[model samples]
Target: MKIFSENITVPASAIDENSHVNNITYLKWCIDVAEKHWLSTAPKQFQESHFWVVLEHTISYKNPSFEGEELRVETWVTLAEGVKSERSYKITRISDNKVLVNAKTVWCYVELESQRPARITEEIRALFL
Candidate 1:
């Protein structure tokens, strides 16, 4: 599968009282990256006909990240079958190259009008490849 990644500088506002990146901030980044990855390659017609909704999220915190640190956030689709896709995420500090967070999210494709689950087509799976 194709891997999408970008570097982000940790903002002061993203740090919580614990003096590190907040849990919610990390979660938000994971979702945002996944959305970007999907939209970057998925055709407009397919997007109009279907949308994805998160069914589950599993995140692990391995290390703490501080404000002003540059982090590498990476995401990729691990599997896309049936009506669901499993995506994985990894966040690491650029300085020490330490893994900060690892996460996986399961998203279900649903029809636009009826909001019912839709089967994954070969074309849709090839979009990421």
Candidate 2:
């Protein structure tokens, strides 16, 4: 499977009271990378016609990361069918290659104007494949 990846440096703003990257920050990163991949790979017409909404998210925190750490976030679409698909992510600390987080999110496809559930088209699936 082809994976889309981005590297991000942990900033002070992302840290929480626990002194590590906050849970919410991880979620934000996941969505950001996913959206980026979709926008960069999908056709313009498809992009303007469809949007996605998170239906579910399952994340595991395996390690803690500190400020100034460079993190590599990699994501890929695992399933695409009907009105929904699944995307998975692995966030690793760049220096040590420690897997800090593993996550999967279920997203529902929707029409941009109607905001109603839309079926995934063959062309859209091909873009990811």
Candidate 1 residue-wise lDDT, 1-129, digit = tens? 689998999999999999999999999999998888878888999888999999999999999999999999999989999999999999999999999999999999999999899998999988764
Number of the top-ranking candidate, with TM-score as the measure: 2
Worst window of 10 by summed lDDT in candidate 2: 120-129
In candidate 2, which residue pairs clash?
none
Q: How many backbone clashes does candidate 2 have?
A: 0
- Stretches off by above 4 angstroms in model 1 are none
Query: Which regions of candidate 2 fall more than 4 Å away from where they truly are?
Result: none
Candidate 1, TM-score vs. the true structure?
0.96
RMSD in order of candidates: 1.0, 0.7
Error of 1 at 87 (Å): 0.4
